[model samples]
Target: MPAADWRASRLVPRRAAVSRAQVETVAGRALGAFGLVFGAQTVPTAVDQARFMADGSGVAMMAVVYGAIAALAAATFTRVAVRAAALAFAAIYVIALLAWPFLVVDAAGMAGRTPWLYYLCTVATTAAVIALPVAPAAAYTSAVPAIYGVVRLSPSGGGASALIAVLDTMYAVILGIVVLVIITMLRQAAIAVDAAQEAALERYDAVARRHATEIERVKVDALVHDSVLTTLLSAAASRTPAERALAARMAADAVRRLDEAAVEVPGLDDRVALTVLTRRLRGGVAGFSAPFIVRVDGTDGVELPVEAIDALSSAAMQAMVNSVQHADGPIGRVRRELEVRGVGAGGCVIRVIDNGSGFDPAAVPPSRLGLRVSIEERMVNEGGSARVESVPGEGTTVTLAWPAGVEGSGE
Candidate 1:
């Protein structure tokens, strides 16, 4: 894809799909709220019946049962157990609504004194609508009221007339339908917002990675110009066999540096023994004209991520190469050392030390890729660090350490 098209595609926002469980939770909460309100409205009727009854109980007990169901639905919506419990409570609600007349005394005389009890059908239907599938919700919401209306509006029944009973029942049914529609829309909206946020984050990450890659490419080009290209030109201009030989070595060193750059620290999860890393470092410097000694401490049973190994080994080799090419003392007399130390905390420390004339590290220009890109940047990229210490007439020590242990080592 073209850059502009790719950018637009990634940046464009879209709606996310809502999960069934979330919809169920929202529906459960809404139904639970309605049930609580309906139950509260029945309180006065419950108190009145309790006062008049010989045992001070009857319809009032039924109100308590309904309230308990509402509370249980509300509480379990956030729990995993709600799936089964919610359906069970909804079944009890539908049965109670259908059996309303049988459960109460003076059903006809009670009349409008308990309008809220009729509305409880709305509460139960809405709960079912939230917790149950479409087919079952439609069946229960429509069936319970259809049965109640028949029993309520019959000629023998002394409650409300047909028109009034139908209107009252319609009030609950229509409200339930409206609430269901609103819940559906809200659930869809929630999903859309979530999708948009995720897309935005992914796009931001992709852009960041592209920018970093471009910057590194420029740095590598500068490195080649300063090191490899310079050595090649010097080789072409040499006047003597000795000068040509030295230039050839420099050009070969430059080529090797480029090749080494291709060997990056493996992913944070890969493991390599410390002994293996030390061997690799020695192998990289085998062509050095000077004496190079490698010392190991605490390498037993120590393993690190591949990336950590790559960074430390490459940096150490670079330090040794610098000693071979620039150290002012006699090649036979000077002692160059590379030490690998492992911390019990799964950390590794590598130091390259040499007793030869050294230049101030600060004097190295920004254009020098050997120290900046090869040593420091490589280490820093892998959660490790490299520090160079040197002064006039004193040898240099390049220290590389990963204090956080190997990446993804579970340390």
Candidate 2:
């Protein structure tokens, strides 16, 4: 909307707003002080008889006109315009010296000769200019006239000049210290503003990244639900009774794994412990051979990334479903033993042994899609491999092994 509002919005806190205003005030004072110094030099040079003032009368008329103009500009204009008016006043003062230098140069007789009404007007105007936004600088420059008047009115040239010199020098020294302090404060304010702006930008960037990541997660989940989930449902619906038994078992296993995975946030993996896994499997693949031996034995304290655990769990569930459903004989004819053996290299082996009507794995066909996802693909994703061994009418066994904390490739 407005420039002021833009500054206010960025301020963020009330203290900052107040500090910024104070800084602006001080900067204007600095500008005004410089303006007064310029005027001090200009006034002396313009009136010197050594210069264009070879004729004195010309200076007075010029000074009078300049004074009137400077007064008007200073009084009517804003704080910024007061600077130009100060120099204008200096110009007018020099010109006035040609006719009325008595006002500035003579301290004792000024009130005696000047009309009372005119004197009041001069005082009011001078006070207003001196107190303008750059009052500090104006006060610094005013030291010149104060010193001149003290020297001019002194009974002894030595005492008065010495007193004026010392007082004026002290005033300048104090003024310089104050100006340097103000400059230091301004520099600090600039640095603070930069830091605040940088923090705001960083916060904005982080929020944007979080939002983008959430959107990507939703997209991936939607793809899984649409393609993989739909195929499982369709296959289950169209099977014969004997086939339907197997399909239902597979469907149940797939749904459980999907449900577990869905709970994980998009960037995290959803695996849990392997012991927790076998307990879950016994419920699904009912004909699993009894007393499965899972020997992490004493190495059971190992923890894994949730994602790797999730993939292994799903893979085991898929392999068991294959053993239970794909057999040519009844469920009672199936024999199975599932074991988890921990390895020394921060890895684990999942072995599924079964006695059932077995077929040549290669001739039986490319691995089923769920087996591809849960076994072969899952094992590879988890930094190991999967193998299926079978001899017809003898038995079948599938072993999937994986590294415990395989890092993602960032592909």
Model 2 lDDT per residue over 1-411, tens place: 122321110111112222332343344444444434444444544443222223444365545554544553443332334335545554444334323333333233232222111111222234333434344535533543444344323431122355554664455445544554555566467447544543443454345446645765786577578655765776757658866776676677667656755565444653344454444444333323222323223125444455555556667766765654443333243446675654442456676777765657766455457566658888888677788888766777887766733322111
- Where does the lowest 10-residue lDDT sum fall in candidate 2? 6-15
- For candidate 1, lDDT tens digit of each residue in 1-411? 123321110112223234333455556665566667777787676555433333423555565557566655555443334446556666776565555555455554455444334646676677666667666777777776766676566422236787977876677678767766776677667456445533543454345445545655776787699888899899889999999998989988888877755443234675767776765655554434445666666677888886677667667766765665455453254567876777663678877888766668888999988789988898899889888888755777888888534422322
After superposition, candidate 1 runs with Cα above 4 Å error: 1-30, 46-57, 60-64, 73-80, 83-85, 103-108, 111-116, 155-158, 198-219, 237-243, 265-411
Candidate 1 Cα RMSD after full superposition onto the native fold (Å): 22.5
RMSD of 2: 31.0
* Candidate 1 colliding pairs, count: 3
TM-score of each: 0.52, 0.30
